[model samples]
Target: MIRHLVLFKLGEGVERDDPRVLEGVDAFRSLDGKIPEIRFWELGWNFSDRPIAYDFAINSGFDDADALRRYLEHPEHQAGVTLWKEFSTWVIADYEY
Candidate 1:
């Protein structure tokens, strides 16, 4: 199995409640049941007040590299990425377990 992790930080002056940000969050949330390649999907806002924390996170599992690739290329996921591009910066990591 492989774990795919992503952490997102909102752009300067961007607030979570902004319409665009809300839409982006909803887009990602909608992916949970929409992609067959996903073995697991969990995402949420960070509640931490620490300076080093990211504003959002995506923790997902896949059966293998091909499954992970399919999920990455999925249309819905790409749409979500487009939305997020307007207001956030992110980092990702993937590894086998």
Candidate 2:
């Protein structure tokens, strides 16, 4: 199994309290059952003061590299990525274990 983790920083002028932020959160949370290759999905919004912490984080599980590749190329995921790009400034990742 492989765990795909991503952390996102919102773009300039994008507030944490913005409604679009919640919409993005919901969109990611909804992908678990909809994407067959996604074994599990979890999302989080940071409310702490950590200097390096991102605004949001997503943790997804896949059965193998092929499953992960499929999830990455899925049409629904592409749409989600498009939506995310609008408000996201930076993205970081960890794709092992």
Candidate 3:
């Protein structure tokens, strides 16, 4: 399986409840039931106030790289990206297990 992890940091001065962030959150949370390629999906807000804490995270798994590619290209995921791109920046890692 392919583990796809992502850590997201909110843009400077952006708040967790900001409309854009809320939309992004909703979009990601909806993917679990909408996308078949996603074998696993976990997404949520971060309550940590520490300076090092990212604002959000996405922990997901796919059957393989092809399935991962399908998730990345899925329209639901793309819509989430649009909202997230406006209010956050993220880093991702993909590994096999």
Candidate 4:
């Protein structure tokens, strides 16, 4: 199995309550049921006040690297990424367990 992790930091001056951000969040949350390559998906806003913490996170699992790649290339996932690109930057990691 593979674990794919992502941490997002909102762009400067961007707020969580912004309409675009909300839509982006919904888009990601919706991916669970829409993408077959995604065996597991969990996303949420960060509640931490720590300076080093990211604003959002996505923790997902897949069968393998190819499954992970498919999920990344899926249209629904790409659309969510496009929305997030307008207001945030993120880092990701993937590893097998």
Each model's backbone clash number? 0, 0, 0, 0
Alpha carbon lDDT of each predicted model? 0.97, 0.82, 0.92, 0.94
For candidate 4, write residues 22-69 as lDDT tens digits: 999999999997999888889898999999999999999999999998
List model 1 lDDT by residue over 1-97, tens digit each: 9999999999999999999999999999999889999999999999999999999999999999999999999999999999999999999999999
Model 1 per-residue lDDT at 70: 96
Cα-based lDDT at residue 97, candidate 2: 70
Better of 2 and 4 by TM-score: 4
Q: lDDT (0-100) at residue 42 of candidate 2? A: 86
User: How high is the lDDT of residue 91 in model 4?
Assistant: 98
Q: What is the per-residue lDDT of model 3 for residues 6-47, given as tens digits with 9 covering 90 to 100?
A: 999999999988988888889899899899999999888888
Output the TM-score of candidate 2: 0.87
Which residue pairs clash within candidate 2? none
How do these models rank on TM-score, best leading?
1, 4, 3, 2
* Best-fitting candidate, scored by lDDT: 1
Using Cα atoms with residue i matched to residue i, what is each candidate's TM-score against the true structure? 0.98, 0.87, 0.95, 0.97
The residue pairs in collision within model 4 are none
- The digit string of per-residue lDDT tens for model 2 on 1-97 reads 8888888999889987788877777777788789999887888887878888788888888988889999989988877787788889656453667
